[model samples]
Every structure is written in structure tokens, then in C-alpha cells.
Target chain A: MLEFTFSVILENLLLATRWTILLSLIAFVLGGVVGLIVLFARVSHSRALRTLTIGYIELFQGTPLLMQLFLFFFGVALLGVEVSPWVAASLALTFWTSAFLAEIWRGCVEAIPKGQWEASESLAMTYTEQMRHVILPQALRIAVAPTVGFSVQVIKGTALASVIGFVELTKAGTMLNNATFRPFLVYTLVALIYFALCFPLSWYSKRLEGRLNVAR
Target chain B: MLYQMNFGDLLPYWQVLARGLLFTVVLTLVSTVAGIFVGTAGAWARTFGPKWAGTCVSIYVELIRNTPFIVQLFFIFFGLPAIGVKMGEAEAAFLAMTINLGAYSTEIIRAGIQAVPYGHLEAGSSLAMSRWEIFRHIVLKQAFMKVYPALSSQIVIVMLGSAVVSQISAEDLTYAANYIQSRNFRAFEVYLVVTGIYLALAIALRALLRGIARAVFPKG
Candidate 1:
């Protein structure tokens, strides 16, 4: 039986932590871009566009992120396209994160009162101009705390990419556990590393939420 | 090259898919009920118990909240056996789901409990009710009604989360998909079908929860 040492495992785990952060960043940025488009579509004057956006959000949000990852990874292969696990994982995470971030942002946009839109219109601002100049700036304040909070979800979600054979933090932990025969110790370190990555965002989110509430 | 899709190849496995769907529903229902109770109790403790007790509950909630459910399942299923507690895949999955749901619901329920009007508790006290009686009659019921929407949404999220138990080989919908994919080699079609089913199930579950809310709290 192979025995595990805390020092050896901890060092490896910390090194693997970089991949987790990298994945989270890729997922967040790509998801943010997609979410912006969805948010715009949702708020657009066209009913068809709005309904289509709603469908996209519901489909992504209503399903588990894990299943989504599987579908992307395995489903793409069935289409005779050779895609890497990294590409598949990123695509799935981007879609999942976009759905959630779009919803969060939609709420923020709508929270800006009708009067603001009306005032901007009265000033003869076009829809795009109003959105860019008048409305989004206000909505961005409401969006900040929740956006930061959602990043924690995004970070934790990177773990699911492991199941698809993406070698991130959780996958590394699993590999090390099998090699060292130390499931508990390896997973505890895995959990703690995730905590280290996530807890600060959670704290900052809470702080921002408090500040936002005070401003309101 | 786009492969010609044949969902018909998956037709024979409908029975497996049905059984998996049933298990998913049953697992979700049991866990959501159990989770609500656990969450309510945890919220109560956090709100009314000693400082240390509240702090401990806070820690528990934070730990579960920040970690992935897949990791939690593996820890329970694989790690617990080393300590001599052996549970079947389904049981361990349910236990983990309960713990995971409890942590999330605790935060939601705490917000609901705190939102209860102070006047209601005072009114109960003036009626000479005991503390538990006041809590049960006034605080709990009102808090539940206020948080019903958020709580129901959380339940849907939990139900969707149940799909992850397939990782530990629990015979849920995703497991059925895996089986059908392996058998037919129609991985894409099987998943597409399963995704549609999950979407329908989620909508149906939300409608069911809304119906229950109407029946339970008409005023709400």
C-alpha cells in the first residue's frame, strides 16, 4: 500500500490550483461575453428575440452542469468532430455560466426604474445610446456584487470538468488519491484548496452587497 | 462531417430511461423534503441557539456551499467506507444531496425567518403561548409563505443537481443516458433525448411546487 505524505500532496495540490484558476477565468470571461449578448436579447424590443433568449436561459439553467459537460464532450465526438476535453469543458462551462450571469444581469437591468429609460428617451437618445450612456452605468452598480458572487459558482463548477477527463484540481486530487491510497486526505486538501480560491470571493461579495445596500 | 442522427436507435431503451426518470423524481422528492426540515432546523439553530452553535452552523453551511456536489458524493461514497460506514450508492447519494441541499436552504430559510414581522412574534407572546408554540404557530408558517418562491426555485436547482449522482453510478437519468450511449453508441442522440426529458421534468416540477404552494397557503 502506498502511503501519503501531507507535504508531498499539498505541494502538488497547490500547483494544480493554477489550472483551476485558469479554467475559472476562461469560463468567466467567455461566459460574460455570451451573457452580455443574451442579456441584450432578453431586453430587446423584439418579442421573438426575447422569447428565444428566455428559452436559452431556461434550457441551460434547468439542467445540471455535469450533464451539460457530458453532452458537450461525448455529443461532439458522436458528430465525428475530434475536440479536446479542454475545449469541450470550456464550451459547456461558458454556456452554463452565461445562462446564470445573463439572468443575474437581466435582474440588474430591470431593477433600474422605468423613469430612467423614459428620461433618456425624452432627451432623444436612441435605444443603443440610452443603453450605453444612461442605463447600463446605473445597472452596473447592482450587477457588481451579484456578478462577483456568481464567480464563486463558476469556480466551484470547474470541478465538474474533471469528470470529462479535464485535469483540473478535482481530477488531480482523484489521480493522486488513487496513487497514494489517501482518499480522505487528498479530498480534504482538494476541498481546502477550493475554499481558498472561493472563500475570498464569497467574502468580497458579501462586503459589496453590504455596501450596495447602504448606498440604496 | 455531420453524422446522420437516429434517435430511433434509442427507442428500445425507453424502459431504462423511464425507470431512471422515476428514480430521479423519487430521489428529488425525498431529498427536498428532508432538506427542508434540515434547513429549517439549521436556520432555527443559527438564529436562536448559542453563539458557538450558530458559528458552527455557519461553518457547515459555508463549507458545503463552496465545494462541488460531485466531490461531496465521492467523499461520502468512497471515503466513508474506509471508516467502516458502508452505504449503497443510492443511499450515499441521497445523504450527500440532503447535506448539500440543507446548507443552501439554510441560507434561504434564514432570510425568510428574519423577514417575519416582529409584531407577529409579539402578538404570539401576548397570547401567552410558549416559545415553541409561538415559533410553530406564527414564525415558521409566515416565514415559509414569504420564501416559497425562492425555496421552490432552490428545489428545482436541487432536482437538477440530482443528475450528478450518476457519477457514483446511481441509476438516475444521466446514468440511463450513459448506458444507452454505450449500448447504441448513439451518445449524442441519447443525451439530446435525456436533456429534453430533464427540461420537461423541471417545468413539471416547478408547476407542481406552485400548485402545492397555492393549496398550502392560499393567502400567500
Candidate 2:
């Protein structure tokens, strides 16, 4: 058995952080786009669309993300398409992130008073126009803190993508542990690296939350 | 050859699946009860304990809250053995989830504690109540009442996260799904079915927790 050197484990672990960062960025950005569409559909006038969007949100949020990743990996393969673990992981994380983001955004939207909706309606603004002009701007302010808060969740979630074999930080830790036979050192370092990535975001969210409350 | 779906092959394995579900529920329940005790204590330390105790509690909560639950489980299951501390998979899973939920509930319970009015504590003091009596009789119930809904949600999230322990071969619900899929060569169907089960489990767990919350803290 190879005795593990601190530098070697640290070096490999640092190198893998790039995958974690990139995966989080891709999932968050794409999920935000999808989440925005889901948010609009959820708050739409059409009863069917609202209910369908709610179901979509609940379906993703109510289950383990690991299961979703498994489904996408095998579901794509079943459709006769070549599916990479990277693609499967991304798709799973994206949907999971989108569902959460939609719910968070909806909470913010609901914080807006009914008067704003009627004001826009009285001005003959379309539903799209009202959201774009009157409601979203105000909701966006309330949305900022929770949106940032949810990003921490999304980032930590990338860890699960490792299970689908996307080779991010968590996977890197496992590989290092296997190679070095230093489970304690390697896993401790992995948890620390994640803590380093996550703590600042959590702090920022807390700070934003405080500021948002003060302004209100 | 085309891909075929067969959930039928899994039907006979219902006993195995039942075992997995039992383990998951048992783990969730054990951790939840112990974890809440830890959280309530941690919250007390933060509120009324000495300065050092509060600092230590802060560090514990932040560290656990920041890291993913899977890593926490892996460290307990895989890492501790390196230190000559042996633990079975179930033991490790229980410890990990207890720590994870403990940190979260510390925050929730602390919020509940803070929301207790200063006047009430003073009123208790004027009535010659001991700190313990005041905490147990006055603060605890009110805190539970205020934060019970939030606590209910956290319990469900923890139950859902219990799925990850299956990675360490703890034979949780997800592990059963993996096992059935591998044996039957029906991965998608198995996962889909398991996903539905987990979703239902989350809903059921939330409802159960909410019911408990209502029973524990009567309307004031």
C-alpha cells in the first residue's frame, strides 16, 4: 500500500475542484433559466399550466436527487442515445436546481402585494408585461437573498452528481482514499475543501437575509 | 434487441424491499429523536451556556451545515476505521444523520428560542422559577410551537437524505432499488418506481411530523 503524502492528496483534490465549480455553474445557470420559465408557468392565468408546474416542482423536490440522476442516466440509454455520466449528472442537477429555484422565486413573487397586480392590470398591461415591468422588479429584490441562499444548496448538491460518476470533488476524494489507503486524511480534507467552498456562500446568504429584513 | 421494462421481476423481492424500507424508516426515526435532543441542547448552549460553549456550538453547526451529508457518512463509515474505531454501516449512517440533522435543528431551535420574549423569562424569574424549570416549562413548549412547522420540513429533508446512506451499502430504500435493478436488468423502471416511493415517503413523513408537532404543542 502506498503511504499517502499530504501534498499529493491536496494537489489532486485542488485539481478536482474545477469540475465541482464548473458543474455548479452549468447547473445553476441552466437551472435558473428553466426555473424562470417554470416560475412564469406556475403563476400564469391558465389553471392547467399552474397545476402542472406545481406537480413538476413537487416531483423533483420530493425525491432524492440521486434517484433522479439514476433515472436520467438509464432513461437516456434506454432511448438509444449515447449518454455520458457528465450529461446525466448535468440534466439531473439542472432539473433539481430548477425545481427549487422556481419554488423560491414563487415565494418572492407572492410577497408582492395584490395592489401591484391590479395596478398593472388597470394600466392595460399584459400578464407578461406586468411580470416584466411591475411585479418582478419588486419581487426580484425579495428574491435576491433566498436565491443566493439556495445557491449554497445547489453547490452542495453537485456532490451527489459524483455518484453518477461525474468525477467532481466527492468522487476525487473516494479515488484518493482508494489510492492512498488513508481514508481519514483524504475524507477529512474533502470535507474541509467543501466547507471552504460553502462557508462563504452561507455567510453571504445570512448577511443578505439580515439586510433584507432590516430594509423591510 | 430492444430495451424492455419489467417491474414484475421485482415483485417477488418485496420482502427485500420491505427490509430496506424498514431500515430507512428506523434510521430516520432514531436519528430524529436523538438529533432533536442534540439540537435542543446545542441551542440551549448557544442561548444560555457560557461563551465557550456557544462558540463550540457555532462551529459544530457551521461545519456540519456546510458539508454534504454523503461526505459526512463516508467519513464516519470509511474514515473512522483508519483511526482504529470500527463501526458497522448502520451505526455510521445513524451517527452521520444524527449529526447532520442535529446541526440543522440547532439552527431551527435556536430561532425558536430567540423568538421567546424576554418578558416571559423575566416573568418566570419573578415567579421564582429555576432556569431549568423555565426552560422546560415555558421556553421549550413555546419554541416548539413557533418552530414546529420549520422543524417538520427539516425532518422530511433529513428523511429524504437518508437515501444517501445506501451508498455505503446500508440497505436503505435506494439500495433496494439498486439491487432490484441490477438483478432484473430493468434500471429505469426500478428507479422510477423507487422515486415514486421516496416521494410518497417524504409526503408521509412530513404529515407524520406535522401531526406530532400539533400533538406536542397545544394551541396557546
Candidate 3:
């Protein structure tokens, strides 16, 4: 057995941090696109589409993400497809992030007064026209801060991917602890690294929120 | 090969599942009650207590809020033992959940406390209410009334997050699912059923909280 030093463990954790960042990026960007579709469906003029979207959002929001990861990991294997932890974690996280982002953006869009929709409609604008020319642009402004704030959640969420053996920062921390037998030092560093990644985003989001409130 | 869904295989483990569900519920109930108390005190410190206490509370909130709950659990369960602060898995899970929820609810409750109108404090003062009396009777109740929905949602989120506690061998609903899957090789069915239970639990918990809100805050 080779000796495990503090520096060796730290170096390994730093390398694993890359995956955490990449997974967060993949989930956030993809979830944003899918969440936009869900948002549109949620706000669509058709009641059926709106209802279906609500169920979609509710299903994702209500269930635990850890279980979702398990379903994607072990559940997909039942279908004869070999799923890697990376693929399963990404897929599960994308869907989970989409659900939450959709809900958050829905709140933002709904925050627009009803009169804007009516006024745009009276101008002979169609639904798409109103959304493109009127509502979404305004909603996008309010959506920015909370959307950024939610990315902290997405980053924290990738920690669950470790449970599925995704080898992210948390996974690396556990492995190093196993190797080094220094759970206290290893996990503390893991937490501080997560906090370092997350705290700036959280601070920035709060500042943005403050500025938004003042602008109002 | 198409996978056959056999929930019947899980029928034999009904007791295991039920026990797990009961444990999860009990854990949530205990931690939530305790967490809210911590949150209220933390909120009071942040809003009305001394400066050092407020800063300390703010640090605690941010540190917990910024990190993931699982890491916190690992730290308490796996790491704390190194410093001679040992505990069982369930105890560690309970403590971590309470700390996590306390941080979140502190922020939530502080917002509510701050939103309490200055005029209400004046009214309480005019009524000859003591400082503690004003906070207890006027400020705290109104703050809770204002943020009750947000608090309930946070509670539900904490409950859902509690699934991770199973990782520490806490034997939550997720642990039961994992255990059954290991025995019967019914991963898909087990997870699907567990996920459904979680969804049902989330919905029922929300409804229960709503009922409590209605009973507790009759005007709201």
C-alpha cells in the first residue's frame, strides 16, 4: 500500500472538482432548454397542455432526486442498455433541473400583470407573438437572479451523482477518505471546496436580488 | 429483453417498507419540530438579538446553506467520530437534517420577522407589552403567519432530502428500497414503488401542512 499524504488527497479532490463543475454546466444548460419548453407548455392557451405540464413539474418536484438517479441508473439497465454513471447522472439531473427551472420561470412569467397579455392580445398579437414580443422579455429580467440562485442548487445536486459512482468531488472525497483514513480532514476539505464554489454564486444572486428589488 | 415489472415481488417485504416509511416520517417529524425551534431562535438572534449573536447566526446559516446536506451528514457521521464526538447513524441523520432545515428556516423566518410592520411594534409597545411579550405575542406570530407557506415547503424539501440519510445506514424508505433490490434483483420495481411513495408522501405532507396552517392561522 502506498502512502497517502494530505497534498495527494487535495490534488485528487481538485481534479474531481472538474467533473462537478462540468456536470453542473451540462445540467444547467440542458435543463434550461427543456425547462423553457415546459414553461411554454405550462403557459400555453390549451388547457390540456397546461395540465400535462403541471403534472410533469409536480412529478419531478415531489420526488427525491436521489431516487431519480437510481431509476436512471438501475432502472435503465433493466431495458438492456448499459448506462454509465456519468450518463445516468446527467440524464437524471437534466430532468430534475428542468422541472425546478420550469417552475421558477413560470412564477416569473406569471408575475407579469394580466393586463400585458390582454393588451398584447387586443393589438391582434397571437400567443407566440405576445410571448416573443411582450411577456418573455420582461419575464427574463426577473428570471435572471432566481435562475442564477437555483444553479447553486444544481451544483449541490450534483453531489448526489456521487452516490451513483459518478466520481465527482464528493465521490473523490469519499475515495480519498477510504485511502487516507482521514475522514475529518478529507470531508472538511470536500465541504469547503463545495462552499467555495457555491458561496460566490449565492452572494452574487443575493446582490442581484437586492438590485432587482431596488429597481422596482 | 423487455423488463417485466413485478411489484408482487415487493409484497413479501411490505413490513420492511412500512417500517422504513414510519422511520422516515418519524425522523422528519422530530427533526422538523426541533429544526423550527432552532430556526426561530436563530431568526430572533438575527433580527432582534445582539450583534455578535446575529453575526454568528448568519455564519451558521450561510455555511449550512452553501454546502450540500450529504457532505454535512458525512462530516457528522464519519468525521465527528474522529474527534471523539461519536453518534449512531440515525442520530447523525437527525442532527444533520435539523441543522440543514434550521439554516433555511432561519433565513425564511427572518424575512418574515423583518416584514413585520414597524407600526405593529409600536402598537404592542403602546399596549404596555414588554419587549419579550411584544416579540412573542405580536412579532413572532405574525412573522410565522407571513412565512408559513414557505416554511412548509422548506420542510417538505428537507423530508425529501432525507432520502440521502439512507446512505449513512439510517434505514429510511430509500434504504428499504435498496435493501429489497439487493435481495430480489428488482431494482426497477423497487425504485419505482419507492418513488411513487415519495411522491404520495410529499403530496400528503403538503396537504397536512396546509390543514395545519388553516387551523393555526385561521385568518390566513
lDDT of 3 by residue, A1-216 (tens): 767888888889999999999999999999999999999899999999999999999999999999999999997788798999999999999999999999999999999999999999999999999999999999999999999999999999999999999999999999998878899999999999999999999999999999999999
Ordering by lDDT: 3, 2, 1
* lDDT of candidate 3 at residue B65, scale 0 to 100: 93
What's the TM-score of each model vs. the native? 0.97, 0.98, 0.98
lDDT of 1 by residue, A43-103 (tens): 9889999999999999999888887988899877766889798989999999999999999
Which sequence of candidate numbers ranks them by DockQ, best first?
3, 2, 1
Best by lDDT: 3
Candidate 1 vs 3: which has more TM-score: 3
Task: Give the interface RMSD of candidate 2.
Answer: 1.4
Which 10-residue span in candidate 1 chain A carries the lowest summed lDDT? A1-10
How many clashes show up in model 2? 0
Candidate number that wins on lDDT, 1 or 2: 2
B17-62 in candidate 3: lDDT tens per residue?
9999999999999999999999999999999999999999999999
Per-prediction TM-score, chain B alone? 0.97, 0.96, 0.98
Give all candidates' CA lDDT scores.
0.90, 0.92, 0.95
Residues B1-220 of candidate 1: C-alpha lDDT, one tens digit per residue: 6678898999899999999999999999999999999999989989866788889999999999888888888888877787778999999989999999999999998898899889988998999999899888788898898888999999999899888899889999999999999999988788888988999999999999989998999672
Interface C-alpha RMSD after superposing true interface residues, each candidate, one decimal:
1.5, 1.4, 0.7
Who is ahead in DockQ, 2 or 3?
Answer: 3
What TM-score would you give candidate 3 relative to the actual structure?
Answer: 0.98
Candidate 2 residues lying further than 4 Å off, grouped into runs, are A1-4
**lDDT score at residue A9, model 3, on the 0-100 scale:** 86
